[model samples]
Target: MRKLIAAGAAAVALAAPAGAEFASDPAQHLMRIERDALETVSRDRLQRLMRAAAEADEDVVRVSYDGDWLAGQAAPDGGAEWKCLSEALYFEARGESVRGQFAVAEVILNRVESSVFPDTVCGVIEQGTGELYQCQFTYTCDGAAETIHEPEAWAQVGKVARAMIDGAPRALTDGATHYHTKHVSPRWAGVYPRTATIGVHHFYRKPVRVSSN
Candidate 1:
């Protein structure tokens, strides 16, 4: 009879949920955050889970990606991905309308999706960050301190970054993977197809080809 009992206790141990792991793992923290938001999981256990996740920068954005949840969102908790997006919006389109800001975010997100660019937001934005003037974005290599003196602007842009990171739709730039402000027209602008003009910026995308027999 004992020999016929398959795996018994050992199998049960393997099946135990990831509850014990919630303390040290950020992935576990995300699960805990979702559970806590729903208020359906072990509430007391979630407190510890959340504490673990909040210690890291990337996982905090998991809970407050929506604009409505800004009240509980902590901007400093953002990891490098969030920082890149927020800084881009701040320097590129903070003066533009909210729609335009989102449009810029859309462009950055589009770059992430494209095969030519990096797979992650941070990688795309920081592609040319260290070069003198060849950096993809001007602010990165322009020698200005990447400081946030405008709390209000930072907060708003933080929300935009979170929104974009959470897979927000990309409609503003017409799938544009590149953009330049109206003040300067780079030589590449003539080669790349102009997709749309949003606020002070001109958006562009590489032309799609139709195969001809």
Candidate 2:
């Protein structure tokens, strides 16, 4: 009876599956499972990398300095900041060329960066308001009503403002924080360093004050 039982046990061992070695050793089985999982993860990672590379190869739209380019763009809309900037450009620079409009926007944005001026677009534009001839932007304190009369001109400046607020390069102005029309030479024009002259505007960078102890 003992010999018959041993023969049956050996027959069962011979009939085990192909991975009997792994089945017999728990550590080996766990290692095989981990290796398969790692392989699957590596395949997934490779697929993601390939997809990103393909996407990177697609065309990207960029800002252009031209009238046709602005006209081609869809009408833009934005929040308070955009409205303030658009209004400023509309009133101050509606007659300016597209390049000139961007230059004026650069001055406003540059002022926002300077410690001397308000940090926000609206704040910078509205500085010194409520008094005649006291505001930073003349249009704000000019006592004239601010209204959007020309849809075409307003739309053009709206696009300019949007492009500027969306991180358009300020190469046109050379970091100008102040600008005036070519017709008027303000007292400060001689004080600050003139950086650029674009269209009808002359751009200047405010001089840094030095203190003598």
RMSD of each: 14.9, 9.4
User: Model 1 scores what on Cα lDDT?
Assistant: 0.75
lDDT of 1 at 203: 93
Worst 10 residues of 2 by lDDT: 22-31
Question: TM-score, each model?
Answer: 0.62, 0.71
TM value for model 2: 0.71
TM-score top scorer: 2
Total clashing residue pairs per candidate? 0, 0
**Candidate 2 lDDT by residue in tens digits, 1-213:** 656545554554566587777445544455566689999999999999998987864533367889889988888999999999999999999998899899999999999999999999999999999999899999999999998999999999999999889888788878899999889999999999999998889999998778886
Task: Give every collision pair in model 2.
Answer: none
Q: Could you tell me how far off, in angstroms, the CA of residue 63 lies in candidate 1 after the best superposition?
A: 17
Name model 2 segments beyond 4 Å from true. Answer: 1-61, 210-213
lDDT tens string, model 1, 1-213? 443333433344355576755433444455555567778546767887887776754533343333465556556337889888999999877887677788888888888888778998888888888878888888788888888788887888888877778666676788998899899999989999998897898999967565696
